[model samples]
Target chain A: MKGWIYQLKSVRKDKFCIMSFFLPVLVAILLNFAGSIDLSSLGELQFVLTAGDLTSETTEWLARYGTVMICQTEEELISEINDPSTNLIGIEKDGKGIKTILSGDEWAILQQAAGTLPLLYEQRESSAQVGVQILSRPDILAGYQHIFAAMTLVVAMFMGCTFNAMNIISEKEEGVVFINEILPMSPKEYLIQKIGIGFVFGCLSALITAAICFRLPFARAAVMLALLVLSAFVSSLIGLFIGRFSNGLMIGVVYIKLVMIVFMAVPMISYLAGVENRILTFLSYLIPSSATLEGIMDLANGGTAMAGKDTVILAVHGIVWFLLYLLLAGRGKKQA
Target chain B: MWNHNKGNRDPARTNHRLTGKSCKTRSIWKSLRSLLQKDFRMMRSGKFFAVALGSLLLYTLFIHFAYVRFMDMEIYQVYLYDPAGTQRNVSPLVHPVASLEEMDRILHKDANSVGIHVTDGKPEVSLYTASKKLDRHRSDYALSLLHPGGKYTPETVGGNNLEQKNRRDITCELLFIEIVAVGFLGIASVLFKEKQMGVMRVHAILPLPKSLFLFSKIFLFLATDLVFAILLVLCNVGLSGTGKILPGLLIQTTILSLVMALTVFGCAMILKDFRQFSLAYLVIALFVTAPVFLSANTSIKMTWIRFHPFYHIYMGLKHAFFGIPVANPLYYLCAAGAVVLLFGIVKTAFCREMEKEG
Candidate 1:
C-alpha cells in the first residue's frame, strides 16, 4: 500500500499512459459518428458511365434512381475526371445483353434497378406509388459501437500487456528488481500490485471508452468495467510471462504481436464464433477478447453482461494465466 | 596496451593506400553487407525471423484449412414470423419463428438479420437497418424469397463465384492488415531492442551514411513482407491465381510495407521507451484502419475517405487481388513520396536520439 503512491506517481508522468488512454477512445467516438450516417438513404448518386452507342432508353432507365451522364470513353466519366482515383463505371453493349464495370453491392443494386427498368417501361402509362417500410428496427449504432468497441478493447489490452511487460524489464535493467526482492513484500504481493494497477487502468479505459462510445446504463457500465478489469489482468499475465523469459527489451513485444492477433482478431470477426469448425469456436472461449466482446454485446442489448459460458471461460483464462505468470516469475527469480 | 593497439592500426599507411575514400558502389555494398549482418543478428536475438516464420505458417494453415471454408458463410440471416402459416413457402434460408416475440428476440440477438412480418396475408419487411441501401436490399431479399420469379434480375457481377469473391476480398484485407499492423510492430520491436542495448550510441560514431541503418531494417522487413505475401496469396488465392496478381501485389505491398515500417521507425526513435511506443498503437491503428475498412467495405461511407491516404492504398491492393492493378501514376507517385517523406522524418528523429544518448 505504501509503495503504490510511487507507482501512481510514475504512471502519472508516463507519456504512453496518457496517450494510450485517450487515442482509442477518440477513435471509438469517430467510428460511432461515422457509423451514424445512413449512406443508403442518401438521395441520388450521380453515376458517370460510358458505353458504345448507349441507347437513350438505358440512359432514361438509370435516371429514375439518379442523374446518369454518358461519356464516349471510360476516361471521360465526369466523376473519374474530377478525382484521379475514382472507380470508372462503364456499360458494355454485348451480344448477350448488357454488362457493367461494377461488382459486389454496386452490382446487386444495379441488378435491382435493372429489374425496375422493365417495370418502368411497362408502367410508363400509370402513376404508381412506391415506398418501403423498415419493420424490425435493429439498433445499427449499437452493433457498430459493439464491434468498434471490441476492436478498441483489443488494442487497449495489447497496449496494456506491452506497457506492463516493459515496466518490469525496465526495472530489471535498472537493478530495482533486486532492491524490491529484498523488501518485505512477497512475490505474490508484488505481482498483485502490478496487476492491480493494470486493473485500475483497464477499468478507467473501459469507463472512458463506454462513456464516450456506448450509452450504457450505470449497472451495465459497471459490469463492463469489471470485465475489462479481468481482461486487463489476462493481458498483464501475457506481459509478465513474456517479460520473465525475454532475453531483452523487444523480445516480449515481438511475441505479444502474435498473441495480440490470436487473442484479439479471431474474436472480432463474430460470425466465426458460429462456424461448424469446433477448434475455431472453441478458441473463442479460450481467448479473453472473444468472451469479452460477447459480454459487451450482452450489456448493449440489455442482457446480463457476463453470462454463464463466457464468464466461466474468461475466469478460467484469467486464473490459468495468473498461475502461469506466478510460476514464471518464481523461476526467473530463482535463475537470477 | 594502448601503444600496442596504436601500432596495429597504422592509420598513416592505410590512409595512403586507400586515398582516404573508396569508390561509391563498393563502399556502399561493403557497409550494407556489415550493416545487414548486424541487423540480422539483432533480429535473430529478438526472434523476429523465427516469429515471422511461425506466423507465416500459422496464417497459411488457417487460410487453407479454416478461413477459406469458414468465410463462405451465409450473408445475413433472414427471420420469418407468419402467425397463420402465411409464409408456408419460406425459403430454407429463412428461419421461421412461431411467434412475433420469438422473431424480436432473434433480431435483437443478431442485429444483422432481416425479418419478415406477415399481416393481412401480405409480407412486411423488418430489419435493423444498417444503411438505406442495405435496408432496401434486405427488403428486396425477403420480397424475392416470397416471390423468386420477380421481374427484377440480380445478375452476378464479377467473374469469380461467391466463394472465390469472399476468399479474394478477405485474403486481400487480411494481408494488408498483417503487413501494416504486424510489420509496424516488427520494425519498432527491433528499434526498441537497439534503444535498450544502447546500440544507437555506437552507430552515432560509426563512419557511414546513417540511412544504411534505416535501410537495413526496412530491407529485412520488406523481404519478410514479400515472403508473407507469396505464402498468403498462394494459400488463400491458390498458385494459379497468385501468378497473375504477384507483380501488382508486390508493388502495392512494398509501398504499404515501407510506409508503415518507416512510420513506426520514426515513432520508436522519437518515443523514450517501449511502453510509450505501445501506447501509440491506438492512434496508429485507428489512422490506418478505421477509414480504410469503413469506407471500402461498409455501407457507411465517409466522403472524406477519398482524402484519406490509406483508402487509396487499400483499394489498390484489393484491385490487384482481383486482377485490376491500379494504373494511375499519381497513386504510385503519392506512395513513393510518402515513403521518402517518412524516411526523412525517421532519419531526423534517429539522429536526434543518437545525439541525446551521446
Candidate 2:
C-alpha cells in the first residue's frame, strides 16, 4: 500500500508523465482526422509535363490523358521533374519518339501510365474494344485507420515499460534503492509493487486509447481489457529486467530501443505488409507485444474476442518474464 | 612590500603576465579535450557506439535482403477468369483462374489482388477495394494487360532504375530516423548521466565556460552522426554516385545533428530526470516527427506542414539524397539561425542547472 502510494505520488508530481497519459488520445484523434481525408480525388490524371516541339495532333492527343504542361526547354522539364513536391512526368521529343523523365519515386501505376502514353495515344481509337467493369467489395479491415489505431494502442501499452524502467533507474540514480535496502519490504514485494503500479497505468492508458478509438460491445471490451492487463504484466516484467541489469539511463535507453524494435516494430511491419512467412509468424507469436497487438487487432476487426491463441501466448509470456524477474531478484538478494 | 613594488615594475613581471594569459587559453583547450574524451569514454561504456554499429548492420541487411525484396513484390496481383478465351493477348503477369469460386477464394486471401471476370467479350474487374483511386488504378492495370504488345518505350531521365531509387529513398529515411530518434535520446541519456553523477554541478565551480561543456558534447555527437551518415549512404546508396551526394548530405546531416543534440541537451538540463525526459521524447517522436513523415511520404496533405520546421529539414535531407540542391537561401539562413537560438537556450539551461542545489 505504501509502495502504491509512493508510485502514485511520483506520477502526480511529474507533469510530463500526466501529459503522456493523454498522448494516445491525441494520436487517435489525429489518425481519425487523417482517415477522414478524401483520397479518391488524388492521382486521377492531373499533371503531365512535356518539352520541345510536338505537332498539334500530338499535343491534342496528350491532352486526352491529363492537363499537359508544356515546357519551353528540356532543362526546364528536367527542373520540374527534379522537384520533390511536384508529381510531374516529363516527356521530350527525341528524333521520331519521345522519352520520359521521372522523379523515380512515382507510383508503379503512374510509371506504367507514363510509359504506355505513346502506345495508348497510338491505339487511342481501338483501346475501347475490351470493356472494364469494376466490382468493389467491402474491405474487412477498412483502410489504414484500424491498423493505425491498433498501433496506437500497442504504443500506449508499451509506454508502461518505459515508465517502469525509468522509475527503477531513477530510484537507483537518486539513491532510493539504498534506502529501500534498509526498509522493511522484501525485494520481492518491492518488485511486485513496481510491476503492479506499471500494470495499472498501462491498463489505464490502453483503456483511454480504446475508448477514444473504438466503440466495442461490453464483452469485447472486457476481453480487450484482459489482454491489455496481460500485456502490461509482461511489459512490467521486461521493464524490471531492463532496470535491474542496466547501469544507467543511457544503457536503459538502448535496451528500450532494441526492445521496441523487436517487440513493436517488426510485428507492426509484418501486420501492415500482411507477410505470410512462417518464420515471421512464429517470431511474432513468441513476442509478447506482437501477440497482444495481434489480439487487439483481431478484436478491432470484429473477431470474437475470447480465449484464443494470442491470449495463451501473452499469458505464457507473462509467466516466463515473471519467473525470470523472480530468479534475478533472488540472485540479487543472495548477492547482497 | 618594497620587493613586491619593485617586482610589479619589472620587465620580467610583464612577461609573466603574458605567459599567464597564454596558460589560461591552453587550459581551456585542455579542459575541452578532456571533456570530449570523458564523454567518448562514457558513450563507449554505455555501448552507444556498439548499438549504432548494430543498427547500421541491421539497416543494411534489411535494405539488401528484406526491404528491397518486399518492394519488388507486385503491387497488386491481377487474376483473370476468361471461360470464352476472348482475351488471347493478355499479359503473362496476370494469372488465369479456372472458375469464379477460385477467383473469390484468391481474392479473399489476397485482398489487394484484382480479379477480371470476362463474360462473352467484356471484362469485369472485382476486388476488395482499398480506395476509389487505387481501385481504379488496379482495374486499369488489369485492362492494360490485355494489350501486352503495346509497350511504353519512354527514355528514363536520371537512368536510376527502380532498385536504385528504393535504396536511396529508404536509406535517407532510415538515416533521418536514426539521427532524429536515436541520436536525440543518446545525447539525453549521456547528459542525464552527468546530472545524476553530480559532475555537472562540479563543472559549475570549475574555471571553464559552461558553453564549452555543451560544445564538446555537441561536437562529439555531430562527428559521430556525420560518420554514420557517410557509412549508411556508402553501404546502401553504393559507391557509384555517393561522391556527388555526400557534400550536401553531410551538410544537412550536420545541421540536423547539431539541432537535435542541442535541443536534447537543453531538455535534459531542464527536465529533472530520465522519466520526464522520456515523456518529452515520446511527445517529440509522435507529435513532432510523425506528421512530418505522413505529409512527406503519403498522400495525406496537411496545409500547415509547411510551418513545421522538421518538415523542411526532412525535405532538405530527402532532396540531398536525390541530388537536388536546396537553392533557397532562406532555408540555410533559417537553419543557422535556429542552431544559434537553440545553442543560446541550451547554454542558459546549462547555467541554471549548474546553479541548482543538489
Candidate 3:
C-alpha cells in the first residue's frame, strides 16, 4: 500500500531475489524430511536368532521389524540365514549386547536394525517396583520443524538482508544513487521503503517456513510472527550497515558473512543448552536470530507466553540497528 | 621447504656502490613473504582479521563456559502420567502429573520430552514418534525409568569420561563447521576484492607466480584455522587433554582447510558475484553439511553418506580429537588429490577471470 510495495513489486521481478527467498526454505524442508526417513527397512531379509531362549514377545517384535527365523544351533542358524533365499542377518544373544552377523546387499540395514536391540531388551527386561504412565512427547514433525524453523529463519533473514543491502550498495557502486539523492523525497522515507521490503521478505520467509513446517496454535503463531518481524528489521538494518562499506560486492560479502556467522552461531551453540550452558544460553538471547529461535523453541515446546527476554532483545536489536542505519544510510553518502 | 624452486633475482640498484650489494632470498620465500604481506594487508582492510579474532574469542568463551556444561546435563525430560496410582517407585527424574489431561498439556508444551502414560497398572508410552527406530529408543527409555534395567549390562568401552568425550565431540563439530563455512567464505570474499580491483589481471603481468596469489590466501586461512583449532581444543577439551592429540588435530585441520579453501576459491573465481555465491553457500552449509551431521551424529542414516567427502573428513577430524589419528593412507591421498584437483580448476578459472574485460 505504501511506496515500499511498489518498489518491491519491481524488485520481485528479479529472478535472483525470488530464488533467494525460495531455495533455502525448499532445501531446509527437503533435508528435514530426508533426515526423518526410515533407514531400517531391511527389505526382503531373513534374520535368524539363535543361542538363547528368547521370549515369544521378543520374537514377535523381531518379526515385526524384519523377516525373522528361529533355530537352535549356531551352524543351523548360519546355514538358514545364509541361504540364497535370504538376505542374511544372524543375531545371537551376546553377554549383554547382541552379536550381529551379516553380509548382504542389505548389510547396513541389518546393522541399524540390530543396533536397536539393546534398548528393546532394556524395555523388555525393565525392572520396577511400580508401573510408569504417560504424559506427552513432541510429534516427530515438530521435532523436525524446530530445526527447519531455525534453518529457514537464519537463511532467509540473512540472505534477505544481504540482498536488500546489496541492492542499495550496488546502485551506489554503479553511480545510480547520486541521481536519486537529489530527488525531493526525504532520505528517511526512501531508506525505509528500500529496507522495509527487505524486512518484509525476511518475515515472509520466516512465516512461510513456520506455517508450512510447524503446527503451532494460532496465538503462538502470532507471537512467532511478531518475533519474525522484529528479527527481519534488525537483520535488514545490519545488512544496510554492512553494505555501507561495499567497495564492491566482495567487501559486503565478507562483513555480511562475519555478522551472519555470529548471528547463526548463537542459536546453534544454544542447542547444547542446560544449566551449565547458562552463559551460552544467555549469549544466544543477545543475538536476534538466536533469540527468535528460543521463542520458536518455547512455542514448539507448548509454551503459551512469549519469552520476555527474547521480546526485549528483539525490540532492542531492531531499534538500535534501525537507528544506526538511519544515522549511516540516512545521510545518503556513497563510499568513493 | 623444497629446493626445487630457485632464488629471487636481485633488485637492480641504481647506485650499487652506495646501496650495498643486494642479497638474494630464495624465490619461493621472497614471493611468499610479499604475497603474505599483501594478503594480510587486504585481510586487515577488509573485516576478515577482526571478524576472525572476534569469532575465536566468542567461540572459545562459549565452549569453555557453556557447551561442556550443557553437554553434561541430561538430554530428555521424562513426563509421567499416573492418574490411578499406577506408577510407584518412579524415577525422580520423571515428573509425575495428576491426570492424563495434565500430562497431555505438559507434553503438548514440551515435545522434546518423553511422556509415559500409566493406565490400568500398565505403563504405556505416549508421545509423537519421530521414526520407528527413534520411537522404540524413546519408548525403551521412558519404560526403563518406570522399571529400570536391562537383561544385558552396559559396559563403558572408552577411557575418556562422558564429559571429556562430549568436549572432543562438540569441539570437533564446531571446528569442522567453522572451517567449511567461515574459512571457506574468507578466501572467496578476499579474492572477490582482488577481482573487483582488477588486481588479478595486473598480477598476471608481474614477476610473481600466479599460483602465489591463491596459495597466500590459502596459507593465511590455514594458519588462522590451525590457531583456532589449538585454542578451541585448549579451552574446550582442557589443557591436559591437548598433549597427545595436537599433532593429529593439526593434520586433520590442515587437510580440511585445504579442501575447503580450494573449493571456495574455485567457486569465487567462477561465480559472477557474491550474491550467487550465497546460494552455493546455502546448498553447501545447509544441504551438504546438514545431512552429514544427521548421518554422522544422529541415528538417522543415509545410505550414501559414506561416499560424501565431508563425511570422511568429519570422521577423520572426530577420530583425531579422540586421540586416534585416521591411519588410512587412502584418506590422506584422497585429501591431497582433492586439493590438487581443486587448485587446478581454480587456476584455470582465475586465468579466465584475469583475461576478462573490465
Best by TM-score: 2
Which segments of model 3 are wrong by more than 4 Å? A1-18, A28-142, A170-180, A196-238, A241-255, A258-336, B1-29, B73-154
Each predicted complex: what DockQ?
Answer: 0.27, 0.38, 0.15
User: Which CAPRI quality tier does the interface of model 3 achieve?
Assistant: incorrect
lDDT digits (tens) for residues B311-348 of candidate 3: 89888888788777677899999999988998999888
**Model 2: per-residue Cα lDDT at residue B232:** 97
- Tens digits of per-residue lDDT, candidate 1, A1-336, equal 877887888888886776665666776677577556544433233445676555776666445444466677755553342332232234445443454444332323343444443434344333122234565454465354466666676566555676677778778778887888888987888987776665667556656776776677777776776677777778877777766766556566666666776776667665334455777678667777888777777777677735445666777898998887778778877997
Model 3 misses residue B328 by how many Å? Answer: 2.7
TM-score to native of every candidate shown: 0.77, 0.87, 0.69
Off by over 4 Å in 2: A33-47, A50-76, A83-88, A91-100, A103-113, A117-133, A139-141, A178-188, A305-307, A327-336, B1-24, B73-75, B355-358
State the TM-score of candidate 1 restricted to chain B. Answer: 0.78
Candidate 1 residue-wise lDDT, B195-267, digit = tens: 8878898899988888998899899888888888888888888888889989999998988888888888888
- For candidate 1 chain A, which ten residues in a row score worst on lDDT? A79-88
Candidate 2 lDDT by residue in tens digits, A1-336: 877888889888878766776777778877666546544434444344554377676666555544567777767777766565556767656566555667666657567666755555445556446455555555543644576788888788887787788788878877998998999998778987888777888778888888888889988888887888888778878888888887876777888888887887876876777768898788767778778877888887778543367888888888888887888888888998
After best superposition, candidate 3 residue A246: deviation in angstroms? 7.9
Q: How are the candidates ranked when ordered by TM-score, highest leading? A: 2, 1, 3
Which has the greatest lDDT?
Answer: 2
